[model samples]
Target chain A: MLLPYLLLGAILFVLGLIGFVTRRNLIIMFLCTEMMFQGIILNLVAFGRYPLKGAPTFDGQVFALFLIAVAAAEAALALALVVLLYRYQGTLDANAYRMLKDE
Target chain B: MPPHPISLSALLPELILLVAGCAVLLLGVATTAHRRRLAPWVTLLALVTAVVVVLFEVLITGRATRPPAAGSGLFYGSLATFVRIAALELGVLLVLVNWSAGREEERGEFLALLLFALTGLLLVAPADNLWLLFLAVELVSIPTYVLVVLSRSNAAALEAGTKYFYLGALSAAVFAYGLSFLYGVSGTASLAATTRAVVLALRDPNSLQGGLAMVGIVLSLGGLLFKIAAVPLHFYVADVYQGASSPVAGLLGFVPKLAGLIAIFKIIALTGFWDTENRAVYWLLWLLAVASMTVGNVLALRQTNIKRLLAYSGVAHAGYMLVGVLAGPLAGKALATDGVSILGNGPAAVLFYIVIYGLANLGAFAVLGLLRTRGGPCETLRDVAGLLRREPGLALLLALAMFTLMGLPPTPGFWGKFALFGSALTASRLTGDTWLIVLVIIAVLNSALAAAYYLRVIAAVLLYENDQPAYAAPREAQSIGALLCGFLILIFTFYPSGLMRAGQHATRELSEPRATAARTESPVASAVDPPFASP
Candidate 1:
């Protein structure tokens, strides 16, 4: 049962990683990162249910709680930033802003 | 000695910061009817308050204790306190430097994030358990992800924030993987117990768990090294600095790097490999220090953008400090002829160097923040050509910043480098290694190399023909802020004793000699081990 949850989390995380990397839309990319964070939560909760050695520990659950809080906070600010960028540049395409000239 | 609960008093500074940060966020919404300019000032007030409370706590409490957790309590002591003071002071200075930019948008979110980040760093210095360290590092880092994107008016700002978040998450994952390896090796995450296990592994190179633990330590360093913008992980730093405003760039570069370096110091110190017998730890840090210095300087040499150059320069500085940490751990014990205090001396030098470096870096960033054009902050070398004619005072401030950064005479930076180099030199002498001395020479030479670019800016301001470059106009706030920062740089040069004394006091707690210094000995040293376990 725990293994199934872990597998689900792994798939979600991979999908989110792909979306974040391949997508051009800044907001969608950010959403994908949040999706990846959810995957982390899933893994943490599953681990909380079934400890590696014996009895379940609260460490995994506490960590998961922090992750959820952080992710929520992150999404709020990230979305706000995306909105601000669109206002400034009139677009959400991540590729258009390549002004940082690398030498 | 038995287990005792972790003290809440030890966590007061973080509590104060969190409460203030939440207040700023709440006021961000509640004060909609107030003028937008009021929010940043309020945030600034909160930061100042946080600093005062931290100062009071450190000065009044004298010492705060953390209970020994199974995995994280090994990094506790004055070393952590001193580092927190240095890092938090940098955060406070950042608020002052970037006030001109933060005020322009009427956004207090930056202030809240800045306070929150400092809170995280404060917690990081004292984290004794690996799990605690993990949580604390995120506490420091997650807010920064928000800070990067809080000022959303510009395309560059948003792009920088996005890239930073992506990279930050990757680093965090890498860190977790390393931590997992550490947990597997020691069967416990506590640094005290883990050190014993690691020593066993080191003695027998064939040990799978030891090899895995080492890889984990290295991988954990990857995430931290990224924050400090060190070699192999520094690619993101230049881009992020170029895209962010000068103030954000300054905070992004300085605060996190200080936190990372302190964490690195704790990690190195706890591993028990700094002793001469620990050949592996010495070799690793020696290689890391040299690589960081050479790469940062060489890469910085080619940069035209001032921000990019500074970013690379920061990486180089981290390398130099790592050398000090290596020296402190590897040779301090062996060199203790007649109980001559080499242990205190090495770590003391590192702490002092951090304070001096923080001051000088903050001063430089303050001036750079002032040099912003109406469009945004200027990034190019050519943008500062005629600055001397219009703002001689600001030019002088930049000159002082450059001289200090170059580690030139009479400045705190000079003494700071002298401390670091002197410790490394002494360590090499005691350890019978010319290679460490060679690393010092490379560091000094790189300082000279650093002088070229720092002086380039000075020359551009003072000696270059006064042809007005684009966006060379100075705002009133920039002038005032530069003047204040200039005074600070100058003060640091003349009155270095006060800061040095503070740093010295901060390291006084961990300077004891251990009878059981060998790995086969007891897990925790008897010198300052408390009787209670943390609940």
Candidate 2:
């Protein structure tokens, strides 16, 4: 019963990681991180039902709830930063900001 | 399966900071100009109050033992007091470092956000639940991403903030993913319970639970690597450090790294991997330590920008602390051997090193923050040339900081590195792990190599001849802050015993219950509690 949900969670996590690494757009990369969070939250909730050891506890669900709140807070901060970056560069390209190099 | 009890009194400092942070935000947002001016002072007031509360707790809590179920609850005594006071003390230095960092309008937001972040850092030491730890760690960082941008108004600052936010979010997700697995392995979120689970799993050498724990730990470390700016996720360090103003750069160097180290200790101690001996976890930490040290030092060699140079140096410092983490706490063994319990306490050395490192780094940045070029801060090494002639007092302090960073004697940094690496030597002898000895030797060599760049900073200030960058509008606080850090370094160098004792008491049975402390009397207790932390 838990197999499909865990599989989906794993797939989403891998996909988000790929998107995060491969994407050039800053907003998209940020979104990819959020997607990864969603996957982790799903996995956490599923684990609450079918713990890997001993008797199950609702702690996984509790963890997922805290994680969701944190993710939302992170999203707010990420979007604000993206807006600031866009204002400075007039584009969302991650590579555009080269002002902080070693030279 | 009773619920772990929570201790609200142990959580007092955080509560004060939370209320004060909100008050500061409200004051900063008030329509009156005077109310806005009150924000920074409010933060200061809050910090002082929190420090008092923490000290009081230290007095009252006195080697306070946790309930047997505290493995799943917050640790309320020694370790909490150690980290909380350290965070607050250094936090005040951080605040002074940035007294006039950005425009006046940004000061309130900056100080308020800093208070919130400190609140999070204080929570990490006592956090016995994985979920609580994850939240606390995030709380420490999310505001800093904004604080970095608020530190300056330049396009570079904005860009730095953007990159910092993205990476921080990604790392948080990765860290949470790992936490989920840790929960699965134990079917509980309690750190001690997880360690117990790991102990149970290790009973069966071939168990998948052990393998699963390893996977969880690796991924979690992957996420946390961003905090310490370890090798794998250290790409953001130089850029973020270079982009932010010096005061914020100093803040970045110390606070997040401390949080990461504490959390790593908790998780590793959770698995009892250090004691039980897990090959995959062991070697992973080894690689991270070696790689971070090598990469941070090699890359720093070519950087001309001072902030960028310090940025790389910060990474290398993290690598050094990682060595201590890898060594784990050996105070128990040292007591059995020679009565010098401080000798082998790896975590104690780490605590001492961080305090010394934070002061030196903060002092250097405070000195830098006192002057600004047209491009912002004393950017290139050339800007520092003949600074000794132009500003003897400030230049001398910067030189002193560099000496500390180089771990030279007459500075506490020497003892910091000596104690840190000495613990590794102790670990090797106890474990009969010869590779640990090799690792310590390599770390010593890295310190030697680190001196070359640190010398360059001193040489620029004292040796080279060029027009020194004209001091920006002098802020007395920055100079005073720099001198204060330098003074503390000198004091610690002379009277190291006081702080060293604190580090020892703070580390003893830090993660384990009284049951574990009692077991330490036997020389082979390590045979029971043996390894901690991955690698």
Interface alpha-carbon RMSD, every candidate: 7.9, 9.9
Q: After superposition, how far is residue B296 of candidate 2 from its true place, in Å?
A: 0.7
All DockQ scores: 0.19, 0.53
The CA lDDT at B289 in model 2 is 91
Score residue A83 of candidate 1 by CA lDDT: 70
Candidate 2 chain A has its poorest 10 consecutive residues by lDDT at A49-58
Name the candidate that leads on lDDT. Answer: 2
Give stretches of model 1 more than 4 Å off: A1-96, B1-4, B31-37, B57-76, B103-106, B330-346, B372-376, B469-481, B504-535
Off by over 4 Å in 2: B1-7, B60-72, B202-206, B331-340, B511-535
Worst 10 residues of 2 chain B by lDDT: B518-527
* Predicted complex 1: DockQ: 0.19
Q: Over the stretch A1-103, how does candidate 1's per-residue lDDT look in tens digits?
A: 5568767876877788788779988778877877777776676666555533334445455556766776776677667767766777798898877767576
For candidate 1, give the lDDT of residue B42. Answer: 65
